[model samples]
Target chain A: MRSVATNSTARPDAIDERILEELRMEPRATSKALGLKLSMTEVAVASRIRAMEAKGILRVVAQLEFRAAGYNILALIDVMVADRKINEVAEALSRIDRVGSVTMMLGDPPIIVQVQAADSADLHDLIVNHIAMIPGVEQVETNLIIDIAKWRTGSAQLHPTSLPG
Target chain B: MLVDDVDLAIVKELQKNGRSSNREVARVLGVSEGTIRQRLKKLEAAKAMRLGLVTDATALGQTAAAYVRIKARPRHARAIAAKIADFPSCSFVGLTVGRFDIVAFISATSRDELVRVVDAEIAVMEGVLQLDVREPVGYAKHRFDLIHIP
Candidate 1:
């Protein structure tokens, strides 16, 4: 698995930002079509995009609808770890594919993970069976999400010069 | 799915109202119930359309969620993402087109837990930097787009 540079910075160029905006609205937008919209050559658009993705700045993934996938439960698990063993515990939890994100805190007994599974049973298996099994894991708290009033993806605005509608 | 115009119409209707029944969908799309069934089956088989159940996250008492974007050492992003995906708290993970290399959604029971997650776990993870966490104040609308059949 390739990892991004810990301190890497990505500043999307003007054209790159425009391309991203179009793709955000239509993930399936073709490079030729996008280039036409932006008044750029198809080869230019495609090459730039390919480079962006290769640099880990862009990813084209199938955004599956959550509810339709039979995953009706969303929970956030707060984890406290033994300070010295924080990495040990976190590395262990990271091995679980079901856990979506793992982040280490700059605090005592640090490390927290974001997990999503099928339901209560799946969540339990992770927290109870898998997470607890890792040595140096001090505590794990589960919080099931009830309402997500709003969720947004992508940039706030693709262009500041002018709005495209 | 090899969608015809009629099938596309059915999908459009459902995207508007997921709970719509086959009969209702057919009525809205000006098609027959049998046609709806066949199209739906084909779509499912082709992995074009997926059916899902929706619920309110707040009603369930699992409130306070945020997206944590983490940038790991160049050689560490994929391994880090794989490791993070194992926890029960992660909702989704993706390598993205932004300052951060990986992004994920995490929900907590309370603000305190949210802090624990950010300050404790995320900050200490090796090869992680540029951590940007944002909590959504309100969710305006959510929709699934239909595939445009050629």
Candidate 2:
């Protein structure tokens, strides 16, 4: 799987930002249509998009409602592992199908993960049979995601690529 | 919102490529173009799904991603998450169990920016007893792509 880089100082230019915004608004629009909106040639827009995607700079994803998918349980697992085996434990957890997002957190609980299960029984099975069994786990704390009351996606707004003066 | 079989098929197709034309989808599904159009319209209106171009913030320049664990009064957790969700830089905020009452997933252009978000915005929330910040180098699956066609 290609990993989209989440760390870099490189920023998109104004044209690229406009392209991103346009696509964000109309993800289903054809490149030809996007070109018309930007007043830039279709070839320029298409190539730029292709290049951005190849470099993980541009990503288009469709999100479905998880509850509708029968994944009623969503959670965040904060794990404290043996001092030197953080990556080892994280890597092992990532291999599990249920574990979604795994990252090395910078503080007390050095690792954090997002997991989903069919129901409470499955949640228990995962923790008891899967997570707790992982070697080097100094401690494992599971937090149920009570509600995703509000979630605003941060896209095309980080590290603003200041418009040229 | 358990979608019907046809709806699941449409989502399956869109999951593969959100940009698939309605006509093309209809043709592939052995249905009229109008049917595909109507179904898509319903999905859009109901907000059952979203089609958009998303990117890794790191690819656009600012690189750090962190999860802020907030210890607070239980009643205020959801309210606090909603407030943090209003922050433009915040991508996700949720009320969680265990070590923290709430978790806010926010990204920054740099280390300094991350710190400011933790200090100025999150730490100051009313009823918050304490806050913990943890940054992950990468995510194995940072997505909302899961589905159940039943």
The lDDT leader among the candidates is 2
**What are the runs in model 2 whose C-alpha is more than 4 Å off?**
A1-11, A152-165, B27-31, B146-150
Kindly list the per-residue Cα lDDT of model 1 for residues A1-165, writing each as its tens digit.
334332224445688878767766655466789889999998888787666554445444322334433455655565787644665666676677566445556543266565667777887887888877777777876655543322222221111111101
TM-score of chain A of 1: 0.79
Query: Number of the top candidate by TM-score?
Result: 2
Off-target runs (Cα >4 Å) in candidate 1 are A1-7, A151-165, B1-150
Grade the docking of candidate 2: acceptable
Tell me how many clashing residue pairs each candidate has.
48, 3
lDDT of 2 by residue, B1-150 (tens): 667899888877776666778888887889998988898778766666677676647667667667787999977777788899878778777887777888888888798999998899888988888987778775544544542212
In candidate 2, chain A reaches a TM of 0.82
TM-score of model 2 vs. true structure: 0.84
The candidate that wins on DockQ is 2
A1-165 in candidate 2: lDDT tens per residue?
A: 323344444457788889888887787778899999999888888787776765557655556666665678988888889855787887787777777667776556777877888899999898788987888877888889877755534353322221111
Query: How does candidate 1 score on lDDT?
Result: 0.57
lDDT, candidates in the order shown: 0.57, 0.72
